[model samples]
Target: MQAAKKPVTFYLGEEVAMLKLQDLKAEAQSSWETLNLLDGTELTAEAFQVVMRKFGDLRHRSTWERICIQLEALWLLKGLENCDLIRTLAAPDTPIAQAYPAELLDAVLAHPSGLAQVKNGLQQLYSDPLTESDRICAMQFLKRISGYETIDLDLPEISLQAA
Candidate 1:
């Protein structure tokens, strides 16, 4: 495949971050290639830590949209192991936090503990702006993964009263 033609630029106020956007792109490419060749099912703690750190850093950057676009292009998850990305980024107030929250919810939904965790998180998003965003995401997850439906039943019966 051809390399991306446009270069990613950042608005730096002081000392630039250690990892460049291109570096993260390279990591994604490497991950894609690795997953295609000899994909492993388990996430090593070191690697996990590295990925988490990158994501944590990403959440705080002003270049979040660009970075997330690159990541989305690069992150073609191989299996449950790669679900870590989705899990970690599912919640929190960040540009990339809401990026692909629902994309791999199915992976966790398949696991009992993971599913419970997601359910609890959904419940906890009560009144914040992110709540509606996250709730929409959770609803979408249920809909796509299964033929499930989300209903808002304020009153027990279907009373078609005009507001």
Candidate 2:
């Protein structure tokens, strides 16, 4: 039997408005600066070129369906199935990222490498002191990614205070 797709629910903060694509593009451009900084993918220069050629123009529209389709294509690319860069760009709670789709995010989390890459990328993005929008999106992304169970062990938190 065919499965039915559930409608996506967006969790927007009171102050966070869902801005239009032009605004999002401007926000992303100011925050990200370069596509290569999308360390989550670990995509080589050539692969990035391929992506640019394929989805570069189409992404301007930045609809949920379009993002999902692009992510599906990225999943097919050899050695890049776990690349969460594109999905990260669709971070939830931010109009800038278009709000990542749950189904696609689940598919990424299902794989071990995908989980790792996601964590790494999120950490890196969090570390960068970008725009306010970036910070909000990063936190939301972290919350969503942390819910999954992992074989990896938890490391002890480092504290500067006396033990």
Candidate 3:
């Protein structure tokens, strides 16, 4: 018999969203794989060039940083399951190199716009019917930009489980 599934919850203040962890994991993995395949899974030179060209505007720094942070978290969360595959796709020199300003990241994390963008982006990715890869990229993009310390670790154990 199949094992009982684990429940996943995302809580924001009084709001709570529920889902199956197993299903979410599967979707995340599929999305990562698709992204890797599309870009040759190597973060190749061409890929980096493309990324730099596309995200060259420093004016949108907040958006860029938020996306990166989300992506990093998603990578950490989902990549842990398939170490080898994740490693290959997440080479160090990717276009998502250290682009966010330290000061900006701090400000964004502390500001409402940063949090709202991340929350909205995640909600859209989770709810939309897009391929897992697009979702993974979207999350990765957010993670790369948002400040690391912004992730509240002081929350109860249950609160940390969903994200």
Candidate 4:
């Protein structure tokens, strides 16, 4: 017998507005500066799948998805992701690093190395005092890293079973 299903309620929150490529492109054109940051993912399925496996899912996160074209758009996201010498762009005091997505942030904060790297990668791109865009980007960076965290935890675990 087939299982019966209950009616589902979909949550149409803006947080998820940019999940699709169309939404990301549409949302990106809101502002000239942001529109300039929008990048088309002209990736083939095989190539995209490979990139998906090799890199973090920062472009697909909320707020960021609508603003920056994942890391592929603005250079800053990838800079922070590198965290080698780029994190210095962050405000000297960075509470904003804590704004990562739930799952990704949880994993990162739990790992000492990951925590340090994320803290290091954060930056301030707008102004010395940190403009509103800077603030927004800060949270977006955290969320971007959090997407990486989600990717880490999401890796398929392999197992063998006998029937």
Model 1 misplacement above 4 A: 1-106, 110-112, 126-131, 148-150, 153-163
Using all chains and alpha carbons, the TM-scores for the candidates as numbered come to 0.27, 0.34, 0.25, 0.25
Q: Cα RMSD to native, each candidate?
A: 14.4, 12.2, 18.4, 15.5
| Candidate 3 residue-wise lDDT at 16 | 28
Error of 2 at 162 (Å): 33
What would the per-residue lDDT of candidate 2 be over residues 19-69, giving only the tens digit for each residue? 556654454343332333444545464654455455456455654334443
| Residues 74-105, model 3: lDDT tens digits | 44333433222222222222222222234323
- To one decimal, what is the Cα RMSD in angstroms of model 3 from the true structure? 18.4
Model 1 Cα lDDT, one tens digit per residue, 107-146:
3454445544444444443222254565555444345445
Q: Mind giving the per-residue lDDT tens digits that candidate 4 earns over 115-152? A: 44444434322122245665445554544545443221
Better of 1 and 2 by lDDT: 2
Name the regions of candidate 4 deviating beyond 4 angstroms. 1-12, 15-100, 123-135, 139-163
- Predict model 4's lDDT versus the native: 0.36
Clashing pairs in 4: 59-70, 89-123, 89-124, 90-123
lDDT, residue 119, model 2:
54
The worst-scoring run of ten residues by lDDT in candidate 4 lies at 91-100
